[model samples]
Target: MNHGTEFSRRDFIKISSLFLAGSAALSTLPSGIVSGLGSNPMNGKGEKIVYSFCEHCFWRCGVAVHVSDGRVTKITGSEYHPLSNGKLCPRGTGGTGLLYDPDRLAHPLIRERKGGKQYYRKATWDEAITAVAGGLYKIHEQHGPSAIAMLHHGFGVSFFKKMFSEIGVNKIAKPSYDLCCGPARQATVLTYGYPSDTPEGFDIMNSKYMLFFGTHFGENMHNTAVQEISEGIRRGAKIVVFDPRFSTLAGKAEHWLPIKPATDIAMMQALMNVLISENLYDKEFVEQHTVGFAELWEEVKEMTPEKAATITDISADSIRTVAREFAFHAPAAFVHTGRRTNWYGDAMQRIRAIQILNALVGNFKMPGGVVAFEKYPLPQPPPAHEHPAYEKEVHSKYPFFPKDEPSNTIASHEIVQQAITGEVKALFIYGVNLPETMTLGRQTALEALQKVDFSVAVDVLPAEVTGYVDVVLPECTYLERYDDLDNGRAFRTPFVALRQPAVAPMFESKPGNEIARMITDKWGIHGVFAPTVEAGLDKKLKLAGSSLEEIKKRGVLVMPATDLYRKPGEPLNLNTPSGKVELASAQLKAGGFDAVPKYTKHPEAPAGYYRMLTGRKPMLTFGRTANNRFLGDLATAQENEVWVNTTVASKHQLSHGEYVHLKNQAGIVSEFPIKVKVTQRIRTDAVYMVHGFGHNAKELKWAYKRGASHNQLISKTDIDPAMGAVGFQNNFVTFVKEI
Candidate 1:
């Protein structure tokens, strides 16, 4: 097995330091590549262990950060954590790489004008906080608190949210829910009385049939879900996937319907119709636990398998057979209500249909069906400071906002649109890169930020987003600082996870709690902010029936499990109007929307162009991970590639592995040429590419212009009527042979 080479333990240790994780380094690189790897090692002195949780991805696996002297040397998943099960994903393993990235925002920076051009100058904590607070207070004093908008992404979001909420700056936005999971949340909450707080993980291991509609389960490896699915598949759960691209999950499935893009709704409708017509539904369960079934039946009776086949490009017989199989499995089968929902604007309706299907199968609270998880009670923040709250507006031309969950996440595009008109004066960006994640195009985002009178960004990394802001506040990486307590990483079992410092704050970077304290102190905000990060964590620890000492010792505190899954006699405690599953939502009827799912036509890609679809990879978390050296090295699309159908290549006189310049429908051309992956894996009508690549930030040397930036081409979007999520799928593109 040795390729004529051997290394001693000392040599391995010396070489391993080059890679982020020495434990994983041997597996990643091949033989003969090791030539003095660990050049600049972490200044580990006397080895000390610190308990922490990863902020790498949203999964937040509990970690054991080993330190020597005052520097973090290693990060390993806490063996005690049930979520990660002692294994770190690619992103989590590369936590140190992000911490050590050269392009990181090491200190506070204030934007200044030099020769009529905006430039950033380094500032101390006092200088940065005072200036930022001054700008915010000015905006508040001149206009209103509502004129100052706060936009955030990632962990410690609640701190920012509480500040804005208490301060009457009601224009706060958490783009994760608003942009990513809003549609799914709206549909699920409407149907079953609550959203899937477990995110996308269902009780798949309890299932005999697991169905997916354009959902990539294994591909986007949310650690716990990966284990759950692997166990489910092992137990003979029949996996069925429907996607335009033959994804990794699709490959593992017993059946993968290479579905026509934007036609999943039709197939879902057919499945429902077939289940009802064949009397495959659990009639007793429906009668006892559901409302408005008759109305649902009325809508879907005409949507037969034959009709669905015509719309979805799936055969009628196959659709009927799949439906029959799905229903026959009954309460043991689950139709996965996914996270990133459909792009057809009718995403809410489609998700409703999925939830309704699961309901019809009588699976709520069941072992293998839609199981609700538990959450521990934590200390609530002190009552939000009272304020003169102006009537929060929808703030967008594209309507279809959920009546209930309105005004929380003002759309990114809408913010930009308003900023362009000078309606928004002050914008605070926190931990998010708008140029990468937001829709309406990169230039548009830049312009919008430029138009704002004052803007600020807080992050560990310098980014294209930071370039547009008036100030940049460098926040320490997850490894270097403490934050508020994190809970419910494993939703089924209630647990409290803590983030503790593995090392002293490298450079002048500070944690979020410190940043909040300084800003509030400068602004003279009293009785509104936590005195220290430990105070907040202590409050949470006290509430969770655990102590800071226990957390420091074990990294996580897992609560004992209860008989949570629905047993025979339990009632389905639905929060809908009738306290039953709303087969036909009365709430929807109240809002003048559809009560039951309806087939809606999606616009086809015009003549020569293909609908450009963006999907996540296990190694990347949006564009945030693109700059990580370890991840970049392992990244398949570090120099991003488009997944075009083999036919697309021949038709356009293109070749596999050749470079192509893609010009999206809005006349936005790719910043760099991307490699063409001409394969039969994707549909001819559409092209696919992994997101978070093609980053244009000049400071991110490893990531810059390496791949095609999907956000750059994401110039068009369809807003979901119910959830107000920007549909990134309505975008189309045509490739140019010559740049």
Candidate 2:
């Protein structure tokens, strides 16, 4: 176990510091490598390059890890990968920070009751795996397979998912579903008959006009999306942004309408009304390729720009101008269906309005507009083993929740509630830090964690959730492990990316594949996974006329770009119920929901409380990078500050750069104090703060108590009835002068 530290912790920090300084230490590395130093590496003796994909965020950009003397020195974007296209984001190049983090979960841990209190004791891999498997099996035997569920976030969880399928346990949920991508995905499915893919099915680079509801493209830092948006900007694309705060993307907009919070539906309806009333819509296309035009018109006709102006606080003239300009752009114009659209409770309908606007403009499948990208056509190998049919698959109570995604069966918040009610007995928390995750709230998440009969956490960091779990399995970082091949993402050029190890896993940490294999073996189930992770990957690749060895050279096997544009006179063979765009979804109406998007007024903030808004900083992706000190080195990334409107701050007698705590409507105070950012970038009615801070886990030394906990202040949640996506923007907060 003593792999005598060839690179001391101090040495690693020094190297990182040098990299950060843009010094000659990493000058020989490839462009987009460590610290954004773009240089071609001249590989000399004892140097090698390993091609792999990054796990910093879900974009999964391919990276070329440079190894010198058996240490990962730097990472650069792989030219062969479609997502990165030889450009890397800041977070992608900071993988070394995560791998070398001193606070990383170094060994498996088992909770022990000592002195009438619980604490974690380091255990061997065998002991930990056995305990976890035994406990979960006992729960399955006593309560049935339906009692077990998994809440996962990263690609590494695929191995554990396969292991659970062996025991007929299929209830899986991802917190990102309820929090980020669920609304956009489900709304697209209802309107277009197919789910929206990543990049949200937009042809950003070719677009002449882009309308964003509340999407913060520049700040979110989704690699490919940002790259394309930059290209669009260079090509003279006009942008329109409607948001309560003047976000990073808003600053680049041709028009930044400070639309009132919770009144987006009313504004969207007005846009639709303008297109219809002024005869600005694509009449021929709508008549030929869409249904429910009459229903849509009727719904929006009464919601005039003047009426919407009153509700949204944007001028009627501006709304009319944006609508006309949008129509002027024709098929090259499109309304973006924003990510994390789970704001308020009517997210499904809110996004439905965006889809309708795009449809009216006849932009579907058009260049410079909306187009559905294709995924790589990699052939799947035969199942490793067949299992018995599940007694009953857990289902979401929400009617329109996606049933096609094989991984998730219900909402993550539903799983939390189930655990609280004793319906779910066992849980596997994989790569998600539940306490900071805005599912229901930190208190509700803690309650669920405490109520679960048996819980196991597979993570790389000892996050707050780990302290409450029965077993903690140490997972190696992506740079030191292999996950399943990633062909899930759809893109312009379909490709399958690899996740090969750049270096051996440090300490006692093991890959998810190995951990899953051990658990299946303990259950007397063999061949659920291949003999080895490499063997399985090779087998699947071989079926697709490729090999693991071939993919390792480039980090990805790419397919030729598919035709994104539909030819004129082509039949609109859509997957919807009517085989056409549904301006008013019949599926929604049949489910007893609104057929057409409707404007519903949400609750107003109380007397002194302001609506609290949450978002992420560009350099961090919530919990994944919260403890990553390399990314945190920047002053801007160290902690989250509450951005209060200058007028509101003045009214409250609050000074800029002053620390203050926040108290929510339910009388819950923020765990830590946040610095005040008195700025004119936000509206007077609401305040904004970046999410994923105020870490309660003392083990996360770098992230602990860095800022206020946005999730902790979220005492109220609005769940969309149609899709079950959770919305936390309903929570309102007032400044607390004292901690």
Candidate 3:
């Protein structure tokens, strides 16, 4: 694929400076490139173009879809979009694969018993909408709206959220929170006074030094982040990575220290000790812009490098050397607060340690350091007539669980537990395949699904979740649908991008807006949505001082780059209770949690088992691309392989390319055999597997039984008491060789 223009070190520095300086205007595509491609039926080559954003992963990079004879031909990166920068990841370019998948749900279905066996029967849109609306309304009337909940993923969920909100059902949750972004988000809020955003609030392109703790950047393949990291490498930035496995990002690091798993907090404390004891940290910055240093030092004073070396299995001298080097790059260095950070139950404090490290180096808002980017300041149109006040949201037990996140009030695992307990009677599963998702595990997800009184699944594919739901609404793919305005992402150049259709909805599938509208209409609710999805989009755009017509041409409307660097001696006015960076969080302390990060040992693997760590392929997102044949065409993308360390493989008498069924600590065996990859890249104590595979859904022809299910092996999970994030790394698995 055409990844985009390769930048020289000088070119990268020049572009990065100009891009972040708030002076340079964003460049647009040449007018002729897409001239006469939209409205004209025949553009000489009988092709047309549509500007939309990708749905393959949450990065949401803008895409230029080329259509020929009423079908999508190809997808490329939109040069105008800030996130993509005219470059596309492997998944971004594979939209056609998902759009045209044969396993896609062609029509709405309702579960019906046939000959004493339950199975799905085809239903019309009206029938499906009526069933969903009636069930939800009945549940709301009988148990109040608190018993109705929605667990969703993807951009298409906005409309469904509106539908549920109108009836006062606010128990909405995204599995991404409990599983992926929650710990980092809440930790940053406590430490930096703002939640972290994608591209992760860093100036990667200009950084002179970068530190990562188990953050697999290159492997994660977030478009803008990867591009900036490449630029940073070209600019001769030094990198340090601390991970059990030698990940793709580690390969580029100046130092890749394979630290012991679950001992990251101890390593971080040791680094803090070095920075303080060696007088390498910036005292001026710390004094001027932070609070609670005394409390922080008190906690880390005894966590010397030698003591940490014993705990973390890294040499004391090496930890000191890394600390000094990190300090030497002051103001331009940052320890990356990683994504999917809920590794141990102490993830919140772990990230707090990382935040403190960044603060000690005085990197907050500095050039090439930790900087919060702004979102496009697009004004919202007034809500479509206010309804009665929503029920006082039922709060989760976790003290620091975020109540402000509109999309989620409770953790997903809580929702599952509530479902199984019969507290939540109705469920709306949008785009998320629960059995394959890491909420608790396959058994728990299935139990919840079976126990729920009514469950409706809105999805494009007939995923495993759909088979268990009472009703299935076939929502069209991103290529054929329009989601709400996507200005949620914060970036260097603030922008609002559009998700216009590239082709009409295929088969009996409808876009989410239409499905949501139909259901609300069945409930006798009106005016919640505009006359049409496009009309509502146009109205919202006009409110933002732009129109749909104008934005459709470029797919996005961008604001000038915000000035990211701090001026000399500028007073820091953060939003935290202290109005400054909190080295030791008073909020956490008040809540009876640790004021400063503390290290605690986690459970060790049993004699014949290893900790089962999970991640994703750069080309595949969990569940989303599991059945994308075009992406799966690559040998590496076909299935997930269990990466066993060379020594461990020998000990288990397993050879490379052999197949084995993973048996977890709970004695739950993988249904399918996974290929064994004997490599020295990973540590012996832990085995790694890419998540989002092992599809059992026969409807997913391309993905069925492709690999072992990582989620299924996770019989145990550690829940963060403060933030409610779920950590599944505690699960250990041993290999059972396939006959």
Against the reference, the lDDT scores of all candidates come to: 0.74, 0.86, 0.85
Please give me the total number of clashing residue pairs in predicted model 1. Answer: 5
Model 3 over residues 213-272: C-alpha lDDT tens digits? Answer: 999997888999999999999999999999999999999999999998999999999999
lDDT of 1: 0.74
**Deviation from native of the Cα of residue 625 in model 2, angstroms:** 0.5
lDDT of 2 at 534: 92
Q: Residue 122 of model 1: what lDDT?
A: 65
What is the full ranking by lDDT, best candidate first? 2, 3, 1
- For residue 687, give model 3's deviation from the true position in Å: 0.5
Best by TM-score: 2
Q: Compared with the true structure, what per-residue lDDT tens digits does model 2 show for residues 1-739?
A: 1111210110101011111112332333333434432333556858889999999988899899988766777788888898999988888887876877767777788766544445567788899988988989888898899889999999998888889988888889999988788888999999998898776799999999999988988888999999999999999999999999999999999999999999998998999999999999999899999999999989899999999999999999999999999999979999998788898979988988999999999998998988999998888876767767453233335888888886677889989999888798788999989878989999888878877778888998878888777788988899999999999879889999999998898777899999999999999998788778899999999989999999999989999999999999888889999999999899989988899989999999999999998888888999999887668887889999999998889888899999999999999999899999999999999999999999988777789899999999987889999988999898999998975
lDDT of 1 by residue, 173-267 (tens): 65665556767777887887776665463787668899998778766777888788888889888888888889989999888888888887778
Q: What TM-score, computed on C-alpha atoms, does each candidate reach?
A: 0.92, 0.94, 0.94
